[model samples]
Target: MLPVMAETLSQLVADSFEIAWDYLEATGELGNPDIAANHLLDTIEAMIRCGERRRLLLSNNAITAYQRFRAEQPLSLAS
Candidate 1:
Protein backbone atom coordinates (compact mmCIF):
# COMPACT_ATOMS: atom_id res chain seq x y z
CA MET A 1 0.00 0.00 0.00
CA LEU A 2 1.09 3.55 -0.63
CA PRO A 3 0.78 6.65 1.46
CA VAL A 4 -2.11 9.05 1.12
CA MET A 5 0.12 11.39 -0.82
CA ALA A 6 0.62 8.73 -3.47
CA GLU A 7 -2.93 8.51 -4.72
CA THR A 8 -2.20 9.24 -8.36
CA LEU A 9 -1.73 6.39 -10.77
CA SER A 10 1.61 7.78 -11.81
CA GLN A 11 2.91 7.90 -8.27
CA LEU A 12 1.63 4.46 -7.29
CA VAL A 13 2.71 2.73 -10.45
CA ALA A 14 6.14 4.32 -10.50
CA ASP A 15 6.79 3.51 -6.87
CA SER A 16 5.49 -0.03 -7.21
CA PHE A 17 7.66 -0.66 -10.25
CA GLU A 18 10.76 0.72 -8.57
CA ILE A 19 10.20 -1.11 -5.31
CA ALA A 20 9.49 -4.40 -6.99
CA TRP A 21 12.56 -4.06 -9.13
CA ASP A 22 14.63 -3.34 -6.09
CA TYR A 23 13.38 -6.44 -4.34
CA LEU A 24 13.82 -8.63 -7.37
CA GLU A 25 17.26 -7.27 -8.22
CA ALA A 26 18.46 -7.70 -4.68
CA THR A 27 17.08 -11.24 -4.48
CA GLY A 28 17.92 -12.43 -8.00
CA GLU A 29 14.22 -12.67 -8.89
CA LEU A 30 14.98 -10.90 -12.10
CA GLY A 31 17.50 -13.54 -13.13
CA ASN A 32 14.97 -16.27 -12.43
CA PRO A 33 12.73 -14.91 -15.21
CA ASP A 34 9.58 -14.63 -13.19
CA ILE A 35 6.76 -13.95 -15.61
CA ALA A 36 4.63 -12.33 -12.91
CA ALA A 37 7.24 -9.73 -12.17
CA ASN A 38 7.86 -9.23 -15.83
CA HIS A 39 4.15 -8.70 -16.33
CA LEU A 40 4.10 -6.27 -13.48
CA LEU A 41 6.89 -4.33 -15.16
CA ASP A 42 4.97 -4.41 -18.38
CA THR A 43 1.81 -3.25 -16.66
CA ILE A 44 3.59 -0.33 -15.06
CA GLU A 45 5.04 0.66 -18.38
CA ALA A 46 1.61 0.38 -19.92
CA MET A 47 0.03 2.59 -17.32
CA ILE A 48 2.65 5.27 -17.73
CA ARG A 49 2.36 5.16 -21.47
CA CYS A 50 -1.42 5.28 -21.40
CA GLY A 51 -1.48 8.08 -18.87
CA GLU A 52 0.96 10.08 -20.90
CA ARG A 53 -1.07 9.64 -24.05
CA ARG A 54 -4.33 10.47 -22.28
CA ARG A 55 -2.80 13.59 -20.81
CA LEU A 56 -1.35 14.55 -24.20
CA LEU A 57 2.11 14.19 -22.76
CA LEU A 58 3.49 12.05 -25.55
CA SER A 59 6.08 13.43 -27.96
CA ASN A 60 9.09 12.32 -30.03
CA ASN A 61 8.35 8.63 -29.54
CA ALA A 62 8.82 9.22 -25.86
CA ILE A 63 5.90 6.96 -25.07
CA THR A 64 7.03 3.64 -23.66
CA ALA A 65 10.59 4.22 -24.86
CA TYR A 66 12.08 1.36 -22.82
CA GLN A 67 9.56 -1.06 -24.25
CA ARG A 68 11.62 -0.85 -27.42
CA PHE A 69 14.55 -2.24 -25.47
CA ARG A 70 12.42 -5.19 -24.42
CA ALA A 71 10.43 -7.28 -26.89
CA GLU A 72 10.36 -6.78 -30.67
CA GLN A 73 8.84 -3.32 -30.31
CA PRO A 74 5.14 -3.53 -29.65
CA LEU A 75 3.69 -0.63 -31.59
CA SER A 76 0.23 -1.03 -30.05
CA LEU A 77 0.11 -4.07 -27.84
CA ALA A 78 -2.68 -2.53 -25.82
CA SER A 79 -2.28 0.51 -23.65
Candidate 2:
Protein backbone atom coordinates (compact mmCIF):
# COMPACT_ATOMS: atom_id res chain seq x y z
CA MET A 1 0.00 0.00 0.00
CA LEU A 2 2.79 2.40 0.88
CA PRO A 3 4.68 1.69 -2.30
CA VAL A 4 1.54 2.07 -4.40
CA MET A 5 0.78 5.38 -2.76
CA ALA A 6 4.29 6.62 -3.36
CA GLU A 7 4.28 5.56 -6.99
CA THR A 8 0.92 7.16 -7.68
CA LEU A 9 2.03 10.42 -6.12
CA SER A 10 5.26 10.40 -8.07
CA GLN A 11 3.44 9.85 -11.33
CA LEU A 12 0.95 12.58 -10.55
CA VAL A 13 3.77 15.00 -9.84
CA ALA A 14 5.51 14.14 -13.07
CA ASP A 15 2.31 14.56 -15.04
CA SER A 16 1.72 17.98 -13.46
CA PHE A 17 5.23 19.10 -14.31
CA GLU A 18 4.84 18.01 -17.91
CA ILE A 19 1.51 19.81 -18.25
CA ALA A 20 2.99 23.02 -16.85
CA TRP A 21 5.97 22.88 -19.14
CA ASP A 22 3.81 22.26 -22.19
CA TYR A 23 1.50 25.13 -21.23
CA LEU A 24 4.41 27.53 -20.89
CA GLU A 25 5.81 26.55 -24.24
CA ALA A 26 2.42 26.81 -25.93
CA THR A 27 1.79 30.30 -24.61
CA GLY A 28 5.13 31.61 -25.96
CA GLU A 29 4.96 34.39 -23.39
CA LEU A 30 8.38 33.73 -21.97
CA GLY A 31 10.39 36.63 -23.41
CA ASN A 32 13.51 35.38 -21.67
CA PRO A 33 13.53 31.64 -22.09
CA ASP A 34 16.27 31.12 -19.53
CA ILE A 35 14.42 32.98 -16.80
CA ALA A 36 11.18 31.22 -17.61
CA ALA A 37 12.93 27.87 -17.57
CA ASN A 38 14.34 28.59 -14.11
CA HIS A 39 10.91 29.65 -12.87
CA LEU A 40 9.28 26.55 -14.31
CA LEU A 41 11.84 24.33 -12.57
CA ASP A 42 11.21 26.06 -9.26
CA THR A 43 7.43 25.77 -9.70
CA ILE A 44 7.66 22.08 -10.44
CA GLU A 45 9.82 21.51 -7.35
CA ALA A 46 7.28 23.25 -5.18
CA MET A 47 4.41 21.33 -6.82
CA ILE A 48 6.13 18.03 -6.05
CA ARG A 49 6.64 18.97 -2.41
CA CYS A 50 3.01 20.00 -2.09
CA GLY A 51 1.84 16.85 -3.83
CA GLU A 52 3.85 14.72 -1.40
CA ARG A 53 2.22 16.42 1.56
CA ARG A 54 -1.23 15.97 0.05
CA ARG A 55 -0.57 12.33 -0.72
CA LEU A 56 0.35 11.70 2.88
CA LEU A 57 -2.82 13.39 4.09
CA LEU A 58 -5.21 11.76 1.61
CA SER A 59 -7.10 8.60 2.53
CA ASN A 60 -6.98 5.45 0.44
CA ASN A 61 -10.61 5.93 -0.53
CA ALA A 62 -9.87 9.43 -1.81
CA ILE A 63 -7.03 8.14 -3.91
CA THR A 64 -9.22 5.40 -5.32
CA ALA A 65 -11.90 7.91 -6.20
CA TYR A 66 -9.39 10.09 -8.01
CA GLN A 67 -8.07 7.11 -9.95
CA ARG A 68 -11.57 6.16 -11.00
CA PHE A 69 -12.38 9.68 -12.10
CA ARG A 70 -9.16 9.93 -14.05
CA ALA A 71 -9.87 6.64 -15.74
CA GLU A 72 -13.32 7.78 -16.78
CA GLN A 73 -12.06 10.90 -18.51
CA PRO A 74 -11.76 10.86 -22.29
CA LEU A 75 -8.31 11.02 -23.78
CA SER A 76 -7.36 14.42 -25.14
CA LEU A 77 -5.92 14.60 -28.65
CA ALA A 78 -3.76 17.57 -27.70
CA SER A 79 -1.85 15.58 -25.13
Candidate 3:
Protein backbone atom coordinates (compact mmCIF):
# COMPACT_ATOMS: atom_id res chain seq x y z
CA MET A 1 0.00 0.00 0.00
CA LEU A 2 1.47 3.33 -1.00
CA PRO A 3 1.34 5.72 1.93
CA VAL A 4 0.63 9.13 0.54
CA MET A 5 -0.15 12.27 2.52
CA ALA A 6 -0.82 10.40 5.71
CA GLU A 7 -3.25 8.08 4.01
CA THR A 8 -3.18 4.99 1.89
CA LEU A 9 -3.68 5.33 -1.87
CA SER A 10 -7.19 3.98 -1.51
CA GLN A 11 -8.19 6.97 0.56
CA LEU A 12 -7.19 9.33 -2.18
CA VAL A 13 -10.07 8.40 -4.40
CA ALA A 14 -12.49 8.82 -1.55
CA ASP A 15 -10.95 12.20 -0.81
CA SER A 16 -10.64 13.48 -4.34
CA PHE A 17 -13.68 15.72 -4.11
CA GLU A 18 -12.37 17.45 -1.02
CA ILE A 19 -8.93 17.69 -2.57
CA ALA A 20 -10.38 19.28 -5.67
CA TRP A 21 -12.34 21.74 -3.59
CA ASP A 22 -9.30 22.76 -1.56
CA TYR A 23 -7.27 23.00 -4.71
CA LEU A 24 -9.87 25.24 -6.28
CA GLU A 25 -9.86 27.59 -3.31
CA ALA A 26 -6.09 27.86 -3.09
CA THR A 27 -5.60 28.60 -6.76
CA GLY A 28 -7.96 31.64 -6.78
CA GLU A 29 -8.97 30.60 -10.25
CA LEU A 30 -11.67 28.17 -11.26
CA GLY A 31 -12.60 26.35 -14.38
CA ASN A 32 -13.78 23.02 -15.64
CA PRO A 33 -10.31 21.47 -15.89
CA ASP A 34 -9.08 22.20 -12.37
CA ILE A 35 -6.06 23.72 -14.03
CA ALA A 36 -4.25 24.12 -10.75
CA ALA A 37 -4.34 20.42 -10.16
CA ASN A 38 -3.44 19.98 -13.78
CA HIS A 39 -0.27 21.94 -13.04
CA LEU A 40 0.42 19.66 -10.09
CA LEU A 41 0.48 16.76 -12.49
CA ASP A 42 4.20 17.47 -12.60
CA THR A 43 4.42 16.67 -8.90
CA ILE A 44 3.05 13.26 -9.76
CA GLU A 45 5.33 12.95 -12.77
CA ALA A 46 8.34 14.04 -10.73
CA MET A 47 7.62 11.44 -8.12
CA ILE A 48 7.68 8.85 -10.86
CA ARG A 49 10.93 10.24 -12.26
CA CYS A 50 12.63 10.23 -8.88
CA GLY A 51 11.53 6.67 -8.36
CA GLU A 52 13.22 5.75 -11.64
CA ARG A 53 16.38 7.56 -10.57
CA ARG A 54 16.42 5.35 -7.51
CA ARG A 55 16.00 2.31 -9.77
CA LEU A 56 12.45 1.86 -8.57
CA LEU A 57 9.66 0.88 -10.87
CA LEU A 58 6.35 2.70 -10.66
CA SER A 59 4.18 -0.40 -10.78
CA ASN A 60 2.73 -1.41 -14.10
CA ASN A 61 -0.78 -0.65 -12.93
CA ALA A 62 0.23 2.85 -11.85
CA ILE A 63 2.01 3.48 -15.15
CA THR A 64 -0.95 2.24 -17.11
CA ALA A 65 -3.43 4.31 -15.13
CA TYR A 66 -1.33 7.44 -15.48
CA GLN A 67 -0.88 6.84 -19.18
CA ARG A 68 -4.61 6.51 -19.61
CA PHE A 69 -5.09 9.70 -17.62
CA ARG A 70 -2.57 11.67 -19.65
CA ALA A 71 -3.81 10.26 -22.89
CA GLU A 72 -7.31 11.28 -21.97
CA GLN A 73 -6.23 14.87 -21.55
CA PRO A 74 -2.68 15.60 -22.48
CA LEU A 75 -1.26 18.70 -20.85
CA SER A 76 0.64 21.46 -22.57
CA LEU A 77 2.12 24.77 -21.55
CA ALA A 78 -0.33 27.65 -21.83
CA SER A 79 2.34 29.82 -23.34
Candidate 4:
Protein backbone atom coordinates (compact mmCIF):
# COMPACT_ATOMS: atom_id res chain seq x y z
CA MET A 1 0.00 0.00 0.00
CA LEU A 2 2.74 2.45 0.96
CA PRO A 3 4.72 1.72 -2.20
CA VAL A 4 1.69 2.37 -4.39
CA MET A 5 1.03 5.66 -2.66
CA ALA A 6 4.67 6.68 -3.11
CA GLU A 7 4.57 5.89 -6.80
CA THR A 8 1.41 7.89 -7.27
CA LEU A 9 2.88 10.84 -5.44
CA SER A 10 6.01 10.65 -7.56
CA GLN A 11 3.91 10.72 -10.72
CA LEU A 12 1.94 13.65 -9.42
CA VAL A 13 5.09 15.61 -8.71
CA ALA A 14 6.54 14.85 -12.12
CA ASP A 15 3.37 16.01 -13.84
CA SER A 16 3.26 19.16 -11.80
CA PHE A 17 6.91 19.90 -12.57
CA GLU A 18 6.29 19.49 -16.31
CA ILE A 19 3.33 21.83 -16.27
CA ALA A 20 5.23 24.51 -14.39
CA TRP A 21 8.37 24.13 -16.52
CA ASP A 22 6.39 24.40 -19.75
CA TYR A 23 4.56 27.50 -18.59
CA LEU A 24 7.79 29.22 -17.64
CA GLU A 25 9.45 28.22 -20.87
CA ALA A 26 6.54 29.55 -22.89
CA THR A 27 6.67 32.91 -21.12
CA GLY A 28 10.34 33.34 -22.07
CA GLU A 29 10.97 35.05 -18.76
CA LEU A 30 13.55 32.64 -17.48
CA GLY A 31 17.19 33.74 -17.55
CA ASN A 32 18.43 30.21 -16.89
CA PRO A 33 16.52 27.05 -17.68
CA ASP A 34 18.70 24.91 -15.41
CA ILE A 35 18.06 27.08 -12.37
CA ALA A 36 14.37 27.30 -13.12
CA ALA A 37 14.08 23.55 -13.47
CA ASN A 38 15.73 22.97 -10.11
CA HIS A 39 13.48 25.49 -8.40
CA LEU A 40 10.30 24.06 -9.91
CA LEU A 41 11.20 20.49 -8.93
CA ASP A 42 12.10 21.45 -5.39
CA THR A 43 8.98 23.53 -4.90
CA ILE A 44 6.66 20.91 -6.35
CA GLU A 45 8.21 18.09 -4.34
CA ALA A 46 7.99 20.04 -1.11
CA MET A 47 4.38 20.96 -1.77
CA ILE A 48 3.51 17.34 -2.51
CA ARG A 49 5.19 16.12 0.65
CA CYS A 50 3.11 18.65 2.54
CA GLY A 51 -0.12 17.10 1.15
CA GLU A 52 -0.82 19.28 -1.91
CA ARG A 53 -2.43 16.91 -4.43
CA ARG A 54 -4.00 19.37 -6.85
CA ARG A 55 -1.95 19.29 -10.05
CA LEU A 56 -2.76 22.78 -11.31
CA LEU A 57 -2.33 24.32 -7.91
CA LEU A 58 1.10 22.75 -7.50
CA SER A 59 2.15 23.90 -10.97
CA ASN A 60 0.91 27.45 -10.47
CA ASN A 61 2.48 27.77 -7.07
CA ALA A 62 5.79 26.37 -8.31
CA ILE A 63 5.79 28.86 -11.17
CA THR A 64 5.13 31.69 -8.77
CA ALA A 65 7.92 30.53 -6.50
CA TYR A 66 10.39 30.42 -9.38
CA GLN A 67 9.36 33.89 -10.50
CA ARG A 68 9.96 35.22 -7.02
CA PHE A 69 13.38 33.57 -6.87
CA ARG A 70 14.33 35.03 -10.21
CA ALA A 71 13.25 38.44 -9.10
CA GLU A 72 15.63 38.34 -6.16
CA GLN A 73 18.72 37.53 -8.19
CA PRO A 74 20.97 40.10 -9.85
CA LEU A 75 20.09 40.87 -13.44
CA SER A 76 21.99 38.62 -15.84
CA LEU A 77 23.73 40.06 -18.86
CA ALA A 78 23.68 36.73 -20.65
CA SER A 79 21.13 36.05 -23.35
Q: Give one digit per residue, the lDDT tens place, for model 1 in 1-79.
A: 9757536766656566666556545644333345434565565666566664222222212223333333443434322
Choose 1 or 3, whichever is better by lDDT: 1
Ranking by lDDT: 4, 1, 2, 3
In the predicted model 3, the residue pairs found to clash are: none
The model with the greater TM-score, 1 or 2, is 2
State candidate 3's TM-score. 0.26
Error of model 3, residue 49, in angstroms: 2.4
Query: Which sections of candidate 1 miss by over 4 Å?
Result: 1-6, 32-38, 42-79
RMSD of each: 11.4, 12.6, 10.7, 4.1
Indicate which candidate wins on lDDT: 4
Better of 2 and 4 by TM-score: 4
lDDT of 2 by residue, 12-51 (tens): 5455555554554665533345544455445545646654
Clashing pairs in 1: none
Report lDDT (CA) for all predictions. Answer: 0.47, 0.45, 0.40, 0.84
Which parts of model 2 are misplaced by more than 4 Å? 1-14, 51-79
Q: Which candidate comes out best when scored by TM-score?
A: 4
Pairs of residues clashing in candidate 2: none
Stretch of 10 with least lDDT, candidate 1: 54-63
Which whole-number lDDT from 0 to 100 does residue 35 have in model 3?
A: 46
Kindly report the root-mean-square deviation of model 3 from the true structure over all alpha carbons. Answer: 10.7
lDDT of 1: 0.47
Per-model clash counts, in order, read 0, 0, 0, 0
TM-score of each: 0.37, 0.39, 0.26, 0.82
Worst 10 residues of 2 by lDDT: 55-64
